[model samples]
Target: MATINNTPAKPEPVLSAFIKAKCPRCRRGDIFASPTYSLSGQKMHETCSHCGLHYEREPGYWYVAMFVSYAFNVAEMVTVAVGTYILTGSNSPWLYVSLLLGIIFLLSPFNYRYSRVALLYWLTPGLNFEPWRSADKPENPQQH
Candidate 1:
């Protein structure tokens, strides 16, 4: 006869999972249908593979992702500007703008997916780094 181990499993980090495009709830499901860039652009899964978390909250839920995308764009611009200034000691405004534009254009697809993932993680109230594995029923079961 064998005894079973009852120790709970370690939960995956939410930030790391988001960066890897995994579901915020279980941290194991793949958020995107395609691993990388796709011919038809980035395709996202409707629901989590491991858990039953729905991707879309409502019709215009993804509009919030636009703000997240804007934030990412601004950050990317600042980073590129600083990097270019450091690499080439020429403090030209044109150079900074050109490099920023190039970098943004190159990373457009990444920005789109990242923004969506960020919003998904943020919009879900009470989301934790640890997996939400409670046996208790929610206050409102109908509001998923």
Candidate 2:
């Protein structure tokens, strides 16, 4: 019988985890408890319930998420503004501003969620579970 020792696995890259929406650890279980929003518009859970990974290391850790969120918002605004201008050739500032505000409000929650997850995925990549079966097994064990 071979004795197996458990060891923590290497962390995943931030961008990969963020894009895949996988847990920062195993990359198997989902990070969000429920992808759907509640009636009250609050997220169900901030952490990965399946793997017990904390989404926010600290309260202010998510402050950087604002940058990510802002980038998303700006990109959306640019796209909308360009599309509107091209379609209508409108020069009214109020029209563009109103349209931008409406789109931002509608997409705020999504921006918030993605920004948070991206930060977490990047900042704390190793904070995940490594199963013994996968971590302990030799890549090519020789049979005697």
TM-score of each: 0.76, 0.65
For 1-144, candidate 1 gives per-residue lDDT tens digits of 111374334555666777898877667778898855667888889987766678888798889888888999998888877777788888788887778888888888998998889887886566543344311221334557
User: Where's the lowest-lDDT run of ten residues in candidate 1?
Assistant: 132-141
Q: Give me the candidate number with maximum lDDT.
A: 1
**Candidate 2's C-alpha lDDT?**
0.66
Clashes within 3 Å, all models in order: 0, 0
**Model 1 residue-pair collision total:** 0
Q: What do the candidate models score in CA lDDT, each in turn?
A: 0.74, 0.66
TM-score of 1: 0.76
Please list all clashing residue pairs in model 2, or write none if there are none: none
lDDT per residue as tens, model 2, 1-144: 123354536545546656657666545446555453444553535665445556667778778889989999999999999999999999999999999999998888788777776766655555543542123242323443
lDDT score, residue 37, model 1?
Answer: 68
Candidate 2 worst ten-residue window by lDDT: 132-141
